[model samples]
Target: MDLTRDQVEAAVRALRPDMFDFAYWVPEMAKEYRVTSVLYSVVSATAIAHDLSPGSELGVPPPGYPSSKVLFRAHDAHALSSLSIFYKRLYHRMTTGLMNCDIISMRTCQEVEGKFCDYIARQYQRKVLLTGPMLPDPEKSRPLEDQWSSWLAGFRQSSVVFCALGSQITLERDQFQELCLGMELTGLPFLLAVKPPKGAKTIQEALPEGFEERVKGRRVVWGEWVQQPLILAHPSVGCFVSHCGFGSMWESLMSDCQIVMLPFLGDQILNTKLMTEELEVSVEVPREETGWFSKESLSAAIISVMDKDSELGSLVKRNHAKLKEILVSPGLLTSYTDKFVEALQNLLNDTNLE
Candidate 1:
């Protein structure tokens, strides 16, 4: 009723570039047109990129799915090469990913250690450009952004801290104040994105009295949310204080910012451990066996991540740079497609004759 089909198509094309996670969606569009050669897609109400011959749309979904697609990496293009070597023992628990049912059969990962997919069918991880947490509405993001630039202007590159726990992570009142005090003690320039606790209207209400005045002119305090990628990518932001949500972690790494992990819950705890132990890209705030945390420990964590002279800090800095290099490499996305095509060819058992 509003526009002709052509007009609608043009609008979609024009808007695609600015869409959320547009980078991932580009490949999705390609698959829609059958441009992708490797991943078998059976298009229905739900789009399923199956573990089948490249370009193979086998009419109907099998009962369990992927009797032919190899489950895990038989090789490393960061692509899933083959199916489970352990299918016999876990067959009942596992089933083929049904696209209509909202399952990603597999994906590529940046590193071997990165999570690819879930356990049920076949899944893995690969780096893709994240879409959210970019610059906020220019009109709304003003004055504060200007202030960040001004505050960071005198600092050296990779020097300041940008703190933004995602919207989901809310701190207890005492914990919030403790961290605020810690940042104040660091004396290093920082931007804290504060979210109000449940039952609170604004973050300021949770502040310990005079805490704002104490840190006034010394640190930057922001509202419930900010354009995190913008802050992380800022030249002056060397360290990121976060709750270690996977998206935030990736954004930080992509922006070349070192992590100061303050994990609050389940996967976050595991993620912080992995980022520290396996990737060596972040340092966790110290805690005791009883899982107690202190303002002193919080302060020390900020110092450790930002002070490159310290040993762990130095190691984290190097890893941060390395991760950034991998994330922004021009060839990374191309390689994901290339690997899928290669795997698809293998599945069809079709090779070019020499």
Candidate 2:
């Protein structure tokens, strides 16, 4: 599979193989579990070698079996290894680079093949299954409702925007400061749910000096984490400025707030692709090489999204209502799970019969 340049560097430093030949040995292990060894790739693209023989790509197999070259679009590395004994099912769904339409039989997106691949993956590990956001059911979620409303009561009327940057990725100081300044420019109350930067004593280090004081009267609050779902659901939160992480996208969409996106790294770019091009519900900030976003640009994006007259806002709200009808339905999620289990059971039975 394609490994990002960053991922490759990490592998080189951590694995520290004595020779390049060490790479191909992974596929040999997969053969023992009925996996057909194919090409060895780098960065999920770039095929390093095809059906590389012993001593061809790798010097020799290790004590264990060769690793399978599994790809799951939505799954993190851990989820793939956990779900199937032989196959790896990715938990999320998105395009993985471009695919060949001319090819007779090949799938493009991984979500389509996730369960099937997961079945094969189970033949190897079969311990961990990739899962989606296990959000609390809206109907059953009670205390959460009260807690959310209580938090909302503190915000100034029509002044707050909820900001969260998913679970991964942090902003550098310049970016954070610019973002804060943008909030200040809006002259509205704001809630920034920020995770601290590495080795930093406080979030204020990344913020402009006097920012906290400048925005003091208008209910500017910052914390390492907030009950994100509840925050989005709050009536006072008129908009969302986010990193466009898929989970955050889904959360914001369901809550019916207009969204301004600032995506960082990996699938985030692709997620923005769908949001801006496909869904038409959100706006994205332009990112620079220095990883900095301008306060002016941020301010503009925020103003546009927050504007009630903007067509995008109404479109987002309408799309959100429709999406909620599907996403919040217990039947949809349960059906997917039920299908996954049935497939697994059928595969297991065949293996036993064999």
Candidate 3:
């Protein structure tokens, strides 16, 4: 259901007491049922920790903890302030969970976020466990939908550009039109799956005037959910323009497509940086000081990675290929799973001794 901010806050408050009760009940149930351990997701862990131990200190970072500037680079004071607030909230939540949990687990690997994981372990004085990327096994998933399969089959290999800005982002009308127009400017077939812009009832309603006629037969701007992983695996899909969500980040890495990013949220921005700056496997569409991106800039970013002769395109493709090989190597994922299970068993033994 669509909810206003006040409504959301009210709903959260209504649920808070029950949530706390559940958190407290968990420990009791564990004792009564002889449940040896409680493996909590980060958010749940935070709540349990708050209710069970309220005054635990979030200690100072260990030496060599990256400075704020290293973690994020804000262009201006306003941006910096926003980043600071967002990170402070995130850090507090994560640290609380890390402190309370018997085993700290993450859906990440040393190949990607090792340094950050190490920092958390040292700062929180806990053993942080990694679960690798935890990507879905594509083999077990259903095939791509017929309509998408047939449509994609019509194009030559690596010829079409595909863009999905995650399920949560809804651009303003003007910005939405700019995005559509930008894709059209790329002069390549594209599939743009996004929510209808703010104040618009449908994807058709939010289109720039005459936009459909101009881009017909070569573009699709759908407003509903589609099979993302299957679509990404299709042969004709060459480049991926994504919002850099965590799941999408791993998906893009695993695929053979060229990567371009446009991130909106705090974690998303960090994911974009990891791909574009640190990993050197993607190019980001730069935003202005106002956090606005123009059609030209958007088109330019896509083209930089899609063009055959573009040095940036070639560079990322090479780097992505190398990283993908490592991520998909035999037993890499299974090794993480195996280790995670072993860690849990060890924790159980330790608990029994105590």
Q: What is the C-alpha lDDT of each candidate?
A: 0.54, 0.51, 0.73
- Per residue, candidate 3 scores C-alpha lDDT tens digits across 308-344 of 9999999999999999999899999899989987877
State the local distance difference test value for candidate 2.
0.51
Model 2 C-alpha lDDT per residue in residues 1-354, reported as the tens digit of each score: 334445644555566432221123323333333322222112111010111111221222122222232211332222223223221232111111111010011111123223332332332232223233334666676444464467578775544787788677666666667778877887667777776565566886666888777887564546466777777777788888887665676677677677888766444544554565555667876655444577877777888777779776677667656766766566665555565456446655665577
Please say which candidate is ahead in TM-score: 1 or 2.
2
Query: In lDDT terms, how accurate is model 1?
Result: 0.54
Best by lDDT: 3
Where in model 2 is the C-alpha error above 4 Å?
1-134, 138-151, 156-159, 197-199, 288-291
For model 2 the TM-score comes to: 0.61
List TM-score per model, in order: 0.60, 0.61, 0.82
The residue-by-residue lDDT of candidate 1 on 1-354, one tens digit each, is 223435544555665422211122333443343232222221110112232212322232233442232122112111111122223332222222122122132332435232212222342222122122222333455354665667777777877788877877766777777777777778887788878755667778877789888777657777656767777767888889887766676566677777888766433554565577667788877775446467788789988877767988888888878876875578664566666545545533432331
- Candidate 2 all-Cα RMSD: 12.9
Candidate 1 Cα outliers beyond 4 Å, as residue runs: 1-144, 289-292, 337-354
Clash counts for the predictions, in order? 14, 31, 0
Output the TM-score of candidate 3: 0.82
Select the stronger candidate by lDDT from 1 and 3. 3
